[model samples]
Target: MLRWFLAVIGYLFFRFPGAIAGFVLGSLLDNMMGGKTRTFKTSFGPSPTVSPADFELHLLSLASLVIKADGSVSQSELDYVRQYFVQAYGKDRANETFRVFNEVIKKREISAQNICNLLRQRTRYESRLQILHFLFSIASADGRVSEPEVNEIRRMAGYLGVYSQDFESIKAMFFKNPDSAYQILEIDRNATDAQVKDAYRTMAKKYHPDKLQHLDEAHRKGGEEKFKKVQEAYDQIKKERGI
Candidate 1:
């Protein structure tokens, strides 16, 4: 059904006002087909054959896939999306961003290949950076950085215009080794028992999903798992110190 619909719309490009009609028809199909995204006010702006606004909605929808593929999506992952959205674009766009993002995730309609192609066409520079960071955000969101999530993020980075050299830097920096519990807690592994406990407390408060508005169910689940690890790590260290 989706394929036939997509092909039909693709053909409509030459038969009618492709840009205006195609965008509207595709968006309606997306809604009916359960496409996850927010509607933006289409302007007379001649940017690209594809719509940047529409592409961002799809990007975020695809991003949630990276986050949830491994059965988890963390507070860190959601946090990164929010931050990257603001940094790359701004709050207003980010607001529209969440609308489509959570919508797609809720519906679970993800097409990696199609999304990658669309992003390649529409985004660059900071928009591209937002995509890469959103992937890293998913990898790091769970704190422990599961291998599956890392691999998914890498695939996503490839789509997002992250070149090999930059990707290497990101891999080395974020996925090179298993992140330590101390790392999650943002403290020294060698810290005295009390300091480690303090860091854990701080992180727990900081990453609590309730504190993050608009966080989806998947992200909340991931946050709970990460929080569990933080708690366990601190407790284990305290036990060793007999404190």
Candidate 2:
């Protein structure tokens, strides 16, 4: 039934590039509904069981939501989103994904919380964490994350079941401040030097990019960026305390 539906969509859009987009979107929808079914076949084996394409769509949708959290989206936010797509999926695929992204952005009625819930249902914790990180990046693209944007992100995090501490840690990575370093390390400012060292080691182990090896390249890269921030925050705290 799914394949037949896709065939009809392909025929209807036969004269337009949307035919390809329809196919990809339909495949993703089928995967979401069918679960574990192979959407593509190859001589090498099977295509990556996890769909980066679907994940990319969710990421862009969330980004659009974050960009519009302040009641309007900026050119800088749009440009950053475009550059993110180009970097992750290359120019050709990015252009294709951008079409879907625009449609999502146009639907201002759709709740960001709803999108986050769907992501939570369909994705793993690590993948959802990466999505949150990307959303923070989008919100901060205009030099700072607005209060509304931060509130929306926090609400989305709660809906996604991301621990409050982890959400704050990810937020601190993009919006740095003196106290943000402590947040990133998940430690108290008044903690003893020994306790601070222990917290840093624990955070280092928890955020190590190696833990995300099972995910796709884009997610692995996100994890690596997060891990670097964790290290930087720990170093900053150590320097401040002269530990």
Candidate 3:
């Protein structure tokens, strides 16, 4: 049915090329809606791809779930999300995206776990880490992250198959402390100075924006912020220990 509909649309527009494009897209849509785990492809290539816009939309949808996790959305959280949209997309696109976000929040039936699973299947590990980082930021936007929000995020992380240590590292970014710095670097307090430096370098490499350069600009920026936090943690440890 979708193929036929798009075929008509294709015919109405660019003729045969349009029909080919329509068939490809229609098949992608069918696979998505029919619970088939197939890679998305276009007529031109075999490489699977998810558009940046679609990735952003899923991130926003999961964010909405996190925002509503505690049964209420704080003003600060809403403002933070709005700011994110404005910064990532232009004001005009932000307005449109916010409308979609609002609708996502309104539909309470969608499970956060389901969204995370979909993301895990479609996105890379770095991209999933970036999404988790964004969710943590939203949770911390209200000055404090509530217990419910933490639990919800942890559950989502599990659904995404993120390691517990990675989750802790991302969590440490929003909530700062002496211990959190160690967590961010994924190091132990008793580790030698050289070990700490090694940990920092490893983490810096792991979360570097360059690693996520293939992603859209917004996601790359998110990775950069996490990378900066990792660097800051290392610097703080170095300062305290005179390393």
Candidate 4:
């Protein structure tokens, strides 16, 4: 679809050679995005689904990547991932998943791009955003989100097709910098009062817990956390501006 569209546009302007050039470029772009030639649909609703096992495995792969980002795996980070799975899934199921993770996943070389490509193809954009939040949670398990961990997550965000502003919004939830509030709202510090209000409403709707109803309870809870962060950011800004 992308290739054909680009080829047509190219043909209109520059004839057969342009169409060929556009086809090549479009094919590259399509392959980079997992070759899904379907309509580009990004909603909080149901998307092309991955099986539970596949989803869990991809998540563990991402967790493994984040753990090793700082050159050493921290026990606290490992424990955090374990606890999250156990809480989200029962101990029995979580243990079985971890068994496979330890024996198969951790032993192999993990590819962030491949895992993210599959995710971007199979999951909703909101679900991918929650995945970033979960990875950040693991990265900050030891208290502070290290520079290496942040960079690793940033790379994953790109491959996952998460926008930069949305990436920064989730990242801000884990840090306490002065601009954290504005970043959380995905807005500029110089924005006017009405713009601030509009951003808050937009973010509130984006992060609302109900948006993840099709996902598991764990993700719905993650959405709630993000929603609360948006609320907090808006309140902080309001208080500062005396609005």
TM-score of each: 0.45, 0.74, 0.76, 0.80
lDDT of 4 by residue, 87-165 (tens): 7877998898888877885477888999998888777788788999999999999988899999999999999999999
- Per-residue error at 192 for model 2, in Å? 1.7
Kindly list the per-residue Cα lDDT of model 2 for residues 165-184, writing each as its tens digit.
99988988877577988999
Best by lDDT: 4
Ranking by TM-score: 4, 3, 2, 1
TM-score of candidate 4 against the unseen true structure: 0.80
* lDDT values for all models: 0.59, 0.77, 0.81, 0.87
Local accuracy of candidate 3 as per-residue lDDT tens digits, 200-230 = 9899988989877766566688898999999
Per-residue lDDT of 38 in model 1? 30
Candidate 1 lDDT tens digits, 1-243: 444455567667655444456667776786665534432221223234445466667767776777686886577777776775666557897787787676756786577767876666544333443345446655675576677877787777777666654454334435433334445456555787778767767756744545423333433444455456557656666776687
Better of 1 and 2 by TM-score: 2
